[model samples]
Target: MSRALKATAIRLTSASALAVTVLTAVGAAPASASTLTDGISATARAENGNGACAHGGYVGGPNQSSSCYGGTTTAHAWCADFAGWVWARNGVTGLSTLDDRAASFMDYGKKYGTISNTPHVGDAVVYNYNGSDYADHVALVTAVSGGTVTITGGNQGARPGHVSTNATSSYSVGSLPWGQRISGYVSPAGSNTPSLPNPASLPAGTLVKSPNGPDVKVIINGAGIPVAASDVTPDKYDLSKIVLVDDTAFRALPSAPASGTVVHDQAGGANRYVVIDGTALLIGAEDWTAAGYNDRADMGVPTAWLQNAAQRQLTTGIVVMDQTGKDPKRYVMVDGAALYISGSEWTADEYNTQTLMGVPGEWLKAAAKKVPSTGTVLMDQSGTDPSRYVMLNGAAVHISAAEWTANGYDKRSLMGVPGGWLASTVSAQVSNGTIVKDASGANATVYVMAGGVAVPLSYADFTGFGYDKRPLEGAPGEWLVSAAAKAAPADGTMLLSPDSNTVWQVVGGKKKAMTADQFGEGKLSFNDVVGVPTAFTAKFPTV
Candidate 1:
């Protein structure tokens, strides 16, 4: 229920009494019982239409700095502005000072070390996307009951309603739900006990310089100095989530923690990373001189340096296979592990001439079979796909390879036996296989798909372009059924794949790909042709 602000008489209390109440509520003192709680509710000016938003204009309209607490330059989707105003009025120092975007609460929580999973009245709950810096939405906790909490937030409805309590959806405080979208709640001032250890107190390998100065540009390599330079760590924190036809990169972060003062257990190893100076450094490697202090080499940011709780859950125990070469003898890695082929096991002469019965898919399955244990064979990629393969050790694992996981590859310690298995979910992945035909053979502009995602095969590269590409040998179920066999959809009607997960539409008698998320976008609109189209069977290339 939401409403516009209505003036009402409030009971008057002494200044000292008001101060005591706020402090008591924040501290939840010993005198206050926790078990038999009265429960907390909104204490801010969160009443609907209560703030200046009633008088404020729309987004891109004139800025009413005086009325809107200078939260936004101009009136635009003022959910955050309204929230900021309420917090500021309640003397929430951080919200009042940095009230601009709805996501500003995330930064506020990080800076003051006031973020919590446990719900409390007057706390700000934030929702972030992917690993982004900004939050998508925020609400004020109005009440708490068991696992759920009631929230009062602006822009709760489709029309950007005023502050009201909405309970259609709730988030978890005990554990992560899917992408770890909810960034957690921010406690009001004085109710927090934060422990931010000094650099020397943090784990070794933590990159520390000063409180607010230039990064020493040194890297901590656990207890030992693995050469002061970035010979070991990957560089650039920006990772691409989807790659499109034109080779454009598309990345999205649904929820990421506030980008400051965090600790990550690097891949479950002994090495720990603490965010010092807004940069991630390993613990125990805090010795400045050990980093080649005087002539320290640049240890730039690593890709997605800090893994939040959700990321850690997704990455832990997930295995990916990295294959390079004509046959199994060369190199094959399953979750960073490789079958060691010592010495010149295969000289240039012996390697190229070895007689192999099948394609890379067959070889991959064969190699995986050699492993004692492997996960179900749900996905595979051929040798000639245009996208770069394994930029580093098992790079595909870094990218969100949905199809790989969909193909019975999740929750496994090792790659399963070389055969296909049934999957509960089947997401899309743009196949990097070669097009039916190419001039330079550099790569096919388009690729083909059979059981798994499309890829250019070594044999097909010289055979009949992409037209002759056949379904994989051991593919199970209708996933391997030819796309040509499927009936075209009605002109305007978008159709989900035979798997009931993929979505596409036939326009002017041609196939046009679109985002699968649209299935939950309420209804189809004029811009039904919303996203770019490609032929990954169930998936489209991300740009």
Candidate 2:
């Protein structure tokens, strides 16, 4: 027997007992009795045994093998499958294009030109669709009573993954279960689509209200976000654009405002928030000007809206601190993380010159502290420590006074950092590519650094290699003694014989002759060739 006939037989055998149960579940009996010709609504009702079907499992439940599962070997999220099966059984065209994903119904509706915001009996309701992906859920609309939409879907029980009727899972017309909003409704192909207000048709920032309620909302991104009457100011919102809409039309719009909107509580509070990805993050008073939020108009929102919005750390690069003065430490926000900056360092880096945003003490305390970005020059300002350092690959490397002066680092601004962080740095040799000679040693030999080793340069080679044009840093006598072992010029160094036009490219400690053609192909320029005495060029073997 067909499933619909079986449902009828069951009802006929126990009509008295089932009638009371159905009435209690539905609050009132449906407008019409169940029949095979009733379309998808009848098929949906029969499959769930009129809200009596339950197996107590999310997957592999007794309903897994039911018609709602679409005969799959393993149970999956079956809400879409159930809706699709009901529509197909009721002779809806374009069922072949439907899939097990809730979003597929939306695609089918759009392809068949049957998708709209209005709900109708036998239409499929899609929830939480963000465009180009599977929606959260789907259900068959069994009834569209005033202010309420009754739907029958699978995997929707308290335990989930079970077939059920609208009697167990009905919702207000505009909202869905679990805080989800209806993305759209999809009617069967060739069916007469219902007419409804399109929120997208309204211009953003227009003030609107429902005739049934005095509460007003501002339209933003196709959604009506409630704004407190007292909070609406003529300076930010135009009073003439406020329009009254029917309750149903008003409810059809989504409730959340778009990101970057500035909002404050309508009930009158000093607290303000900025919407980001649908959540409101608190913006302290000091941050309003520093973060440039003054540029955005402030909207008064319902108190409930602020209460429901979850707070997260602000993702910005602004400088922030505690306004209470209890914690005088200031921090720079780097990708949502905070890096504490000392007072001296703050002034030296000119952060003191910029506007500082003061946030709540509790929020500043909760922020995660991270290291400063690389390339920052830091010096320990404490009278006990005199070491200066530079940030490299996340760690601080010590820079000697001689090297600092030789490199003209005295001209660069120094950030005063905590002595504790400075103690973590290692007193290592100067970085590669630096020209160095002993600061106090009698040896006047100058060397160019290459991978921590020093390669000696003659007076002629120094000027020829263009090293004379660059800053020659001074190194400690101890470091120079260890690093100044006799070695050839660094690999890739182009050498020119002092008395001849011969040019050689250094490779693996050997010199390779370069032809005119080879030099042009390699993009070698005569300016880069270092002129060395015949004895220096003759030391390395020719390759």
Candidate 1: residue 414 Cα off by (Å): 74
Candidate 2 lDDT (Cα, 0 to 1) = 0.59
TM-scores for the candidates: 0.25, 0.28
Global lDDT of each model?
Answer: 0.35, 0.59
**Which candidate comes out best when scored by lDDT?**
2
Give a tens-digit lDDT track for model 1, residues 1-543: 322211111111112211100011122321121211111233332255443345452221122133233553324445555555555433344344354465556556656666665667667766542222445556676666676666776655434345567542455542233222455676654321122223323343444332111223212322111122332234321112111110000011112322222344332444433332233433343322232322323222233344322133111112222222224343323332323222243332132233221212232343444322112222222212222111111112111244334433344333321111111112322122212222123333333332222332344232433234432222212222332233433355443333334445656545565664555557664233212122222343212
Candidate 1 accuracy as TM-score: 0.25
Give the per-residue lDDT of model 2 (tens digit) for 208-309.
864334567777656787775544562255667777654456766778876667787766778877775566767776667666677877877666657777
Off by over 4 Å in 1: 1-46, 49-52, 55-74, 129-132, 173-180, 191-543
